[model samples]
Target: VGSAAVVFQAARLESVPDRVSTLPEVEIQLFRDAVVQVQEEMKEIKERMADVLPAEERALFDAYVMMLESETLIDATIQRIRDGNWAPGALRHTIEENARVFEQMEDPYLRERASDIRDLGERILARLQSSEQRRTGWPQRTILVGEEISATQLAEVPREALAGVVSATGTGSSHVAILARAMGIPTVMGVTDLPVERMEGREVIVDGYQGRIYLQPSERVREEYLRLYEEEQALSASLREHAAEPAVTPDGHAVPVLVNGGLIADLKPSYVEGADGVGLYRTEIPFMIRDRFPAEEEQYQLYRQVLEAFAPRPVTLRTLDVGGDKPLPYFRFEEDNPFLGWRGIRITLDHPEIFLTQIRAMLRASEGLDNLHILLPMVSSLNEVEESCRLIEQAWQELCDEGRRLVYPQVGVMIEVPAAVYLVPALARRVDFLSVGTNDLVQYLLAVDRNNAHVADLYDSFHPAVLQALAQIADGAHHAGKPVSICGELAAVPEAAILLLGLGFDSLSVSVAALPRLKQVIRGFPLERSRALASEVMQSESSAEIRDRLRQALIEQGLGGLIRAGLH
Candidate 1:
């Protein structure tokens, strides 16, 4: 839950004009001038973002730049207007055509790009309208409401005045949501039922924690949220006081908390303030942002910066986890079931050259500071692990052959597939450690695609079977005398972190935003009590019961603030 807010700032675009017959020459010139003005404004925004935003976020503007620089866009617009079509209609057609291609894509990441196209198209269309048509002035404690809030739209709001954000489109993974989190603003996305047109200047309460919006809230409701808002502030301040403290239970069990990062921005003081280390550095992020594969030198520099930031603190880097939900724009492929198809180790192992280059860069980057830990993603068989190990060794040997001193990094396999759960004993015997990627593990175990909204409700990490699997994996890894850790969304939850602690996870790797609350939860809950709770939940037959039990546990401990509103 984040700070609750009153007053809505509706950010709607001007209505598009209807298509008309050939415009006068003056109208055409006006249209051209508007296009140039919007393009220049976009350029200025990009330049300003260079110093403030991360590389991945700055890349969000690349699509806008591409659209503005497209000769086809201008040429097509001019030709269409000359041939008896309206400028706004012509631009909308082009944007819709481009967006439709991505909208039809199965990958969630690529599909979200369609929103980017629409966002840019709206910006240009807004410029086409008269200045008087646009709304100005933001209210105090503004809850920015829109059909689809863009990164630039979010950027335009004053930080102090912006309390929350709500959108009718996009998911938590959208760029706007990502920026909101980075800025510590509460956000709710994909609110299909939100009455965007009527939300202007309305007194609304945004329950970001629960993804609920209150339209002209009752006085009782407003008072109660006001209480929550004050309590949240006090709790946040208290949590920050202990940010640098170790996550040790009152019963004396110490659990190291690490941050899962992908971008260079993850190295910011805010993110790393309380982080023990970088638990899972998504190497695919660098690859995903680029048009082509990043060279070895480029990879080396990036990895080295992360290594140097938390030197001596272990940083586990997952090697190229692409081809499924995350596909490279440059390296395209078609699959009936991409998630179940050749992804993760399958792709890297198939192309040893890509795998080897990455490994070599990782090894070389860890030259003096030996804090690098290599993690292999989506491993189901013994052969994949063995082959991957061979490639790592080959890379090490090649680097050493060049007379460069390096440390042979510890290797681990991500137990994401059901096959890997049963094979944990064999897998643990081979690798230095095991990391449970609960996100994919739960998806594969429950036979539910977490990304698909239709079945998303059924994707429960607390399912009885999933809990049992976690217990089994932990037992198997411990039996083999190997350390195990969890680095997934499950690890980020305070309740789940408590269960993971009981399940024998050596460390909990969560997002930077989740670190403080997780630490507070860990420090408040006793290890023995957590173990008993885990055992009790494992025996429970339903996920609802498990959640109730967990929620009750939080309330009993006076950590009820961590619970989402309405759950209490």
Candidate 2:
């Protein structure tokens, strides 16, 4: 190893401290140089990847490079001066401006530019202030840093090169969390006061799965980590062995397993996993992935190709579910609570033209396919559902009237909000089917932010209230003779799947990685027992009671025993 380097591990320092040199001029110069370097790097990368990526993706790469080099310093500084002092978020706004530009771009590939731009800016900022600079020490190198890191930066760092990750501040979705999960590297975030500088070049063990970091770990700790790593490896090998098997319940009930895809790249994993179909094909992704709105022909071709790729298998295309938490900068939704604001069916009602265009593309794409379905997200009122159905009919009628070939996909609505659930019986009277978005449903029910770690634990899908609401929606849909499905993270967990099956959900959509395990859970599950458990759970008063009772019931049914053994 080279000379020891002091690593600062702590949270992000937004404001310069009194002890640290507040050299504004130096910071600006360094930023400018960094911008230039990023531009050069982007050009080189584009030159290498141009042939591999589509034309639209190529433009996204170019725009990201431009965003970095595009004098954001001047704009941000101007904002700071206007506000009388620099705010912690001023730089973010300047970056957000570029994000807006990318969001408005009409190309699917370019729309992803915003994610790239935001990630790049965050990385640059982290490098400027973060204690961990790029890899510098020799083989078996020792590097130092301060508090937690963003998930994006961790993802960029070489997994094999780094010994561990320590962060001062990070939530689950932060760059650190995402990167750590992808790399399977040991990491600990939210360690408010860990002394990173003291441990430079020293040995330590990072238990990422447990969210623990050990400095100067003793022999015992090291031994445990080695053993744990071996165990994890063995478990992973086991998971891989039966990845392609169909998920079937021990009682002989088979639930179709599918994948949720946002971008074209997500399709590769879905294909490899042998997903029965694309349960939720987010239409906004293509729109958000590009720099501008895709031309009609382009959208048609892409949708056609995706349909062709998964021919005969059902692919439910959700209309642009933007606004609220997932606001598009270019769309300009000025609401204090974007999540509660106009989105999904609301967006379609307000901008029928945008809705018509997408519907037309989907219709054209499904010309020879019969497995396509149209889904509406965040439907709060019966009118929204009716209007959406009318628009679909109108689009199909226009195409047929104009002698244009079109496919009429079955229409569906997402029962996410409480209002949707309450009115689901009425709403189901019009729509052909219903898919419960449990993530939002739980949040909307509990009035909590699922993404906010402080309240994350409170965001329980199994809360009796949430389960009751879901059961009500499922019952209402069934009463109205419509199929009810669950397409959310909750459906991915074995525990939650038991409840969903008991609640009378006809379909449960989950991620590709969780399918095999979920299948295993299903195969061992007894529907009669699950239904009985569900009835007992529904009658329970508190979430704790529900959780404990459900867990105990699983244990009694042999499923909980498997869970205790970590077979799930």
Best by TM-score: 1
**Residues 451-568, model 2: lDDT tens digits:** 4556656767778788889889889999999998998877866677888899899887765555555666777788777888888788887988877776776666666533433323
> What tens digits encode model 1's per-residue C-alpha lDDT throughout 1-568?
1222212122223323334544445446756777777778877898999999998887767667777778766776676677775566566666677788889999999999888777877776676655322334667788877765655457567777888887776655444564576566777777766666556567877776776778788889999998888777877787888888988899998889998878786798766779899888889878977889999999999999999988889999999998766778799999998889989999999999999999999998999999999999999999999999999999999999999998889999999999999999999999999999987888899887654544656778889999999999999999999999998778867778888888888888877777888899998999999988888888889899998898889889987777653344
Please state the error at residue 165 of candidate 1 in Å: 6.0
What's the lDDT for residue 87 in model 1? 62
For candidate 2, what's the RMSD? Answer: 13.5
User: Which portions of model 1 miss their true places by more than 4 Å?
Assistant: 1-190, 194-206, 214-227, 565-568
Model 1: per-residue Cα lDDT at residue 116? 79
Q: Estimated TM-score per prediction?
A: 0.73, 0.68
lDDT of 1 at 398: 90
